[model samples]
Target: MATVLGSVRAFFAQSAYSIDQENPGDVVARERLLDRAMGEARFRNSSEKLRRGRVPADGLALVARDPDGYVIGTVRLWNVEAGVDASGNAVPALLLGPLAVDPEHEGKGIGSALMRAAVTEAATRGHGAVLLVGDAPYYERFGFFADKAKHLVMPGPSERDRFLALELKQGWLGGAAGVLVPSGRRFGRAGLRKAA
Candidate 1:
């Protein structure tokens, strides 16, 4: 079903926009887009607990740009420990969040494009699984499901049914259980100063 929907989306997706790796120059525009799409409530999301002061996984921060070169969409993935397996070994996973597309571009498929790009990049980087707290109806089309994520938990409050996961490698999430913890590189003072 996911595959079929993916093909259908691909068939109708517009080509006027481009998906690209997020760069320093895109930071401002991306943040503005996110603010408009999610408002102040975005900062209160459960995923923000894992992402605050942490850099996204290497090469996993992405943006969708319009033909005019403006950022129209954004999505980022952060490294997280999806708890421990039954035997106690740490289970590494990527947490995807704040996927937002500009309101003007909402129906252009930019969000879906950014989603595919980020997930594809994670898979290419050999990530085991990707977790997200999002609407199941929307994200499930990308293979994210609650079944595998049932045993995993995030730091803050999140609807159990809304927490979802997609295993890039079959069985990578098998036996996984525990609270998600940030495992990505910290946003250091230097980076903070630069952003400032």
Candidate 2:
């Protein structure tokens, strides 16, 4: 049987597309596509503010490639301490953002494929929740909802309605109320090794 990613690609008639762990060699194309997908002003967004100068979470960055090996879509999850739990210890969560598809690839299921792969990979790696600042309508389908993040705060200004969260592990958001702070861990060029 074909994989779910393949199913999504088939749904969008994108059989030549594939999502894979990001290789450092794709950085330049990723950056160019990001610039085109999000534009230069994207730097001012709240999510960008949080990720500034920090590396994405270990093994959480992924890219969607076309048949020719070009990076056509990208989605990354960064490590963030959502807040304290009932025990007063930091609750680790993933911050998903910059989910971009190349302009030429828009209208295809590339973006959805990237989101599905990123979240699935994150959960498989033992993360409990994912948070993001984005369109409620677009992300809600992926289980992102303002209510899920009602108790948390971003590091900078953001539209209250657009900030959302999804709990891969049930109850991960309950009492997860606090500032979203970066985990401060460095991600090297090698990207973290995938979980065996």
Candidate 3:
């Protein structure tokens, strides 16, 4: 019975792929694939901005690997805080960006698999909402939207249409407003404090 069930599952697996949390040593291949994928995606500027931040130390990265152990896609999340609200409350939020897939592997469901793994891991880790500057149509499929606009601002100039947010948990935004900034201990003790 177990053998039969396993065979049945494999038959309907759709694609023979696996999504997992990226290990530290996978950085080199991940970067190569990311560079290739971003180049193909025509998001050179966005890729450059992400590279300058040293995202690995600040956020979690998940990758989709083929059976041969090659990374074909990747997604990342960073710790960031909202700018400031009228009442002076600093809203804390997560920054999601740099989602890329190997050009040759696009439309193979790798990007979607990476996103699902990242979001699940983030929710389990007790994160708030995730804010990003991306396409509305593509991101909306993952439950991301502009509902948090009043409580969100990007670090740099971003088109209003592209900026979006998604609640990882219920009411994660809580109507808070502020500019997004890096939230990491290395930034200094003063910066380590969470915003109200």
- The predicted structure with the larger TM-score, 1 or 2, is 1
* TM-score of each candidate structure, all chains considered together: 0.89, 0.88, 0.76
Task: Give the lDDT of residue 51 in candidate 1.
Answer: 93
**Which predicted model would earn the best lDDT?**
1
Winner on lDDT between 2 and 3 is 2
**Candidate 2: which stretches are off by over 4 Å?**
1-14, 187-196
Q: What is the C-alpha lDDT of each candidate?
A: 0.85, 0.83, 0.64
Candidate 3 shows a clash count of 5
Q: Worst 10-residue stretch by lDDT in candidate 2?
A: 187-196
> Could you give the candidate ranking by lDDT, starting with the highest?
1, 2, 3
Predicted candidate 1 versus true structure: per-residue lDDT over 1-196, tens digit per residue: 1222244235434577777767888989988998899899989888999999988887777777776789998888999999999899999999998899999899877788778877877887889999999899999999999998989998989999999999999999999999999998889865443332
Global fold similarity of model 1 (TM-score): 0.89
Q: Regarding TM-score, does 1 or 3 come out ahead?
A: 1
Question: Worst lDDT window (10 residues) for model 3?
Answer: 187-196
Off by over 4 Å in 3: 1-14, 40-59, 85-87, 185-196
lDDT of 1: 0.85
